[model samples]
Target: MPHRKVGSSIHLSGQLPFKDGELLGQGVVGRDVELETAQELARHAALNCLAAAVQAVGDLDRVRIVQMLVFVASTPDFGEQSQVANAASELLIEVLGENGRHARTAIGVAGLPLNTPVEIQVICTAV
Candidate 1:
């Protein structure tokens, strides 16, 4: 097995810098939140996650994203997780250029932290 370096294992947390208790509706709180739309929430989650990941590295030049996964907490009828995941994918390309393009997966789950509508993770190769 190939050994994974500590740098490669580093993970970052990204939450939309919305003010606390701003109220995204009955079950939501924070800025850029969509009260009734899963797609919008997914997009916000992806953007926030990527921003946090980039900040974790402290420099964009050291990044080589290998994969991305987005998790959407939603009701059973939600079928647009992939579209929401695109929000993250698009933002990464904007920030990292071609290097940001990556393998990705988007999934819908029953629930998440603070009843958040979305969360994301990234695997990156670091220099």
Candidate 2:
């Protein structure tokens, strides 16, 4: 429910790693969550972003990712934010091919909603 269209662009709100309303991973990375789990969660969140795009645009084939922002809930010493984000990027490319290549920013945050370790926000153009 966190997607909206503006002209030719679709903006998706931060998506957590939930499938069927089940949170896959929780807590801060390097504190209560492992790197591998965080990576998987990132992929899941990215999928959710794509799903929202599909909802707004009606087809995955017509959507091209323009930019993405990944948020990681991690401890002070955790510095692998980019690696965690890579998982999401990889999924996008695998799913959408070249159109999925996008400008991206990965950030570490103290916390996120529902204690989820990974969140992804996507902006796409309906082509």
Model 1, 23-95: lDDT tens digits are 2322332233443364455555555555555566666777766788787665676576787678778877887
TM-score of each: 0.68, 0.97
Task: Specify the poorest-scoring 10-residue window by lDDT in model 2.
Answer: 1-10
Cα RMSD (angstroms) for every candidate in the order listed = 5.7, 0.8
Clashes (N, CA, C under 3 Å) per candidate:
0, 0
Considering every candidate listed, which one attains the maximal lDDT? 2
Q: Considering only N, C-alpha and C atoms within 3 Å, which residue pairs clash in candidate 2?
A: none
> How does residue 46 of candidate 2 score in lDDT?
97
**Steric clash count of candidate 2:** 0
What stretches of model 1 exceed 4 Å from their correct place? 1-9, 13-40
